[model samples]
Target: MYGIVQGVGFRPFVYNAAKKYGITGWVNNSGGAVTIDLTGDICNVKKFVIQVVKNPPFPAVVNKVRCVSLQYLHYDDFNIKRSSKESDTVKFIPPDMGTCENCLKDIMDKRGKRYRYAFANCTKCGPRYSVIKELPYDRRRTTMNSFEMCSSCKDEYTTPRDRRFHAETNCCQKCGPSLVIINNKGEIQKCEDVIDETIELIKNGKIVAVKGIGGFHLVCSGRNKVVIGELKNRKKRPSKPLAVMMKDINTVREFCEVNEKEEEILKSSKRPIVILRKKENIDLPENIAQGQKKLGIMLPYTPIHYLLLEQLDVLIMTSGNISGCPIEYKNSSALKNLKNVADYFLMHDREIYVPIDDSVVKVFNGEECIIRRGRGYAPSAEHMEVQDNIVALGAQEKSSISISKNSYVYTSQYLGNLQDFNCYRNYQYVIKHLTGILDVNPKIWVYDMHPLYVSSAYKKEGIKIRVQHHHAHMVSCMAEHNISEKVIGVIYDGTGFGLDGNIWGGEFFIGTRADFNRVGHFEYVDIQGGDAAIREPWRCAVSYLYFCGYDGKFIKNIDKNILDAAIQALNSSLNCYKSSSLGRFFDCIAVLIGLKNFITYDAEAAIALENIIDENVKETYKYKIRNENNVFLIEIKDILQGVLNDINCKLNEGTISAKFHNTISKLTCDLVLKLSKIYSISKVVLSGGVFENEHLLKAVYYELKNNGLEVFFNSKTPINDGGISFGQIAVAEAVTKKQSRE
Candidate 1:
């Protein structure tokens, strides 16, 4: 049995099933798979096999089960044997799972051995990928090997009837990892009850750095604006939204509107943070989400979190790291780096072998869309139809790595942008760690085409394949949908290197996974000061106005000299590159309609535009698709002029935002329809960061579906740069197959 069969009570389940079916058998974990040997009546053995495969444990994902017949040797009874490490073909690694109800009950039971234990866990839940150091996941191979189990725990492990039987992370307070409270000065705080002390500190508006299953989190009261503001100031994160951990589903419902799907995701074993629309006039601190209409909320996924939230309704549980750094998981590093940001440290001695961040998700069109894949959702393995040892290093931002073994592709959790030295180092570490654990020796290395991408600069000895960024995005969706036929892909994002050596984001491609033709894109506008235009929306606004023959003198809160210099640079084509980024277009509109003149985070302007849309408005602006040299260019001058006219007319910001969003949706439908008709393809794939906007995605999805076209989107993987590595893997496999055939 393969596919998440390790460390998930699969052996124990098999033993129990064998006994129930009156079969004598032994089950053990070996080479990342479960091996079962049984001897009994043929009918009984068949029933046991069916039960094991069809009705596995709660969290065991049985992807493949191979059965073979051999000369049977009678055994006294069913037995759980020790694991073996004799093979290199590893199939899957289960992701870190949230705490199960049974474990929670044990922690809450006053008479239980693990009462109030912060590290309460069993076979059903608790750390897997984060604490794992190698395959054949046994206690000795994980970080828990450092802590010895007491006699009571050993008894439970030896007993087959106990749920904790053979649980790798099972232990009581007497032998398990213990928590310690330390002040910011690195002095130990002596308290009768550490949980009570931590709760008091949080209630007093003090930030606490709490160690969790994967990493440390900077936690505080979500209702306190003063503390939230202080946290933002200390962390140097002004406008970026912070995620809040609510007490339970009821608490989440009080602050945000939750549909059935969102609630199910929140309560799932993979408890990811779900982005939900905020309830009107809620009492949550505005600093939690800045001015955005949606709030990122998650339920407690760990025993420590549940204990921490016992006296609080909601807590701001943001990543514990300095600006531009990966999440801090080490005890010494968290204390040293976050001393100024946190008032106290609620830490534990449990060593986390691999650092993983909480996954972020949102529901779109009644399906889950992963924004950042991590903790509960990764080290994810997907079954593909290819056999090759390949490695794909994703794009610089939202960096992730994928390795292929046999016919399975295993993707690492989300590693942050590679621009920061710490994040880049972590990225390298994850690649080494994942490849080492999976025992994969790569024959092909795939990377983005952008020359300056940190991932592209990674040196390795293998056959290299360079993939275009937007093409990777489009193919990622294609790979998820398992579509090989020709389709029209509307890939839009902030930035990507184009075939002509220019910045491309708004793109229209028609092709399959192996190859694609860039048939259309938004008209190019000079991006004055290059990256500066990305940081300051006013520059893009000025450039758009200049290109559209409109004066930007009315734009306020910007230096006139800087504006004149930018316009001069645009005219001289100095320090300016032509870009067709729809993200930049949103930024330009945001400035024109008085939303923001500058941004503090990636896609801030676009997010704000989406947040303020008036859903009642149904009007759209006019756009033209002009053919130049057999390539279609989406002209935005008319759209810009309409936005400017709306501003002159003093239209409400919400109405203008809605109209602008509607215009983009209309133009997208029009373009996709035109391309689909030309190519005679009904399958349309949408993949990019720009589609992360729920409003725009809903508009385009319903429009295309209503028009009788098959629309596909990335569901299993993120649609952002995080999914690029998977796409690279898919494209590499396709290219390899095509080349071999030729």
Candidate 2:
């Protein structure tokens, strides 16, 4: 059955297959599913099932299909049946697909009718989610209804022998969207051609807002500093790095290092904007990525992008939407909201099926790193070992979901931060869409332990399970690698739900997918005003330094009295929340060393610390260890206290940051090494958001390997909370399966 199967040209596929097998049938979409009834000889019916099972179609991930045979019902030749209003609810939908090879080859074919067509597509490709407005996907329900089909195109669409027959998305220059060129006064301007006019305007330094896959893109020539600066000025995006589009991988290599992972990400079907380290010698302007070390780059995910840059140089293709909102895709809205921001609008009449924002990616340890999951990367299922079909609703902040059915776990694309109401509505929208696309009717559910998490409120039906925060993080890494074997999981992040009813961030749990023990851990320090310390690092420093030799009453003599007061208030608390969080430790140390007193972004202090460290300096830290209460402990406080004495030194910040990084690595290595002889855990997984720091990840990975241990790293998804939903789903599945087995 086809729910989202309507707009994606499902009828054409059924018709062609029937014709090839010499069978007669009528296929149509009803309610949310596409149904087909066949009346033919026994051989044809059997061939239908055989072929459908073997090879269905490109990009059509057939979740399942049921076949039934009966006595022949009298029927004539095969025909496309009109859609009905009712059907079973087992049908699945499909996400918006990129351009197909057939259309791509046709567009590139110089002699073909639709040569170099920017809006060219067939039944196999083009918009599905953005343009769709109702069930039983039809021309009337889509934006395509506005365009009357041209005579030539209509003939091919109706002809039974043609590949374009019944292809609803079938279009050409005669009946497709166009680029209208005009000057500042709205005067119609004349030019040689679309490419030439756009190129000339780009060379002359005009900001062109081009419509693409799920939304509009604000384009400007990267070479012109004035134009780029104007784009930033008008877009209200001065500090945020703008994603740049190059012609191909060759040009991309000139600006950034393209290893196998980076190259794979650049060429991936999703075509996400990949964050890469900028080459030191690149002559690009500084306005590209303000206050950031990496530049966001992407290859063309759409045909229009390739044609637009065919003549023009590198183009700054930022999302064509306003800040603090979803990307703009509707024609009327774009005209109203973006009219002031863009000088000229390169528009089209074809409708965008969805407002899917650009997918963002990065490379880590030679694998594709999905940061913002969208477009080509989403709605695809990941088949993993699980107990039951469980939907793990993710946390409130940086939300996404992991739904498991049968043996597969499908993680939804990046849903925006869930703090805003619009983002919340959008999260629900994505949930409905993903459920429709993958056909996941969860039999059970899982949620974050945090009661206030946005996704924790679902209680409509089924068995609900609340999973701890750090446990979910650990299991996510386990499920991604399908690790049934036992290992020591080091989950070090800012905050997580502790088993002992405390906030745990930095933890070492020794176990497999289902079993675990908090074998060894660091001393818990006060959080000092809860989340306030996360924003103001000085509060954390004040709390940490006060306990370790720095005067707790120094606030009377200090200029920043608020930091001292926070420490004072928290010092005498009856219930001081303590954590062994490695992430919190990093923040506290950053404040201690004068790198930062407050943070504007998450991980900014740690990222900047890694950015300045000189990798060539081969330095080792003295790690202190103790076996207390039959548990091994690495004394990180010793190094923290020692650093306070040398704060007056004139050495570079690189040396200081490197020393801390090395110290942390050494302590982790020492603890693991001591545990190896005592315990049989030879496998270790280095996970959490902190793994996003490549510098820190490198040191930990090498140190663990030197201890003769196998490590599982976050190469696919972010080790952060972004990937926690997957872990939650895995834990739920494992628990359910265990119960059934027991």
- Top candidate (lDDT): 1
Give the candidate number with the greatest TM-score.
1
Candidate 1 deviant stretches above 4 angstroms: 88-90
1-742: candidate 1 lDDT, tens digit per residue:
8878877788888988888889896888887888888898889988998898988998897888777778868899889888888555555777788999999998899998888899988888999999988888999999999999999999999899999899999988999999999998999999999999999999999999999988999999998999999999999889999999999999999989999999999999999999999999999889898888889999999998898888898999999999889999999999999999999999999999999999999998799989999998998888888666899999988889988887888888999889999999999899998888888878899989998888877999989999999999998898888888899999989999988999999999988889989899999988888878888988889999988887767578888888888888888989998999999999998888877898877888888888889999999988899988878999988998888889889999999999999999999999899888888999999999999988888899999999999999888899998999999999999999999999
lDDT of 2 by residue, 490-536 (tens): 87787776777777776777876665777777667776767767767
What are the Cα lDDT values of the candidates? 0.90, 0.72
TM-score of 1: 0.99
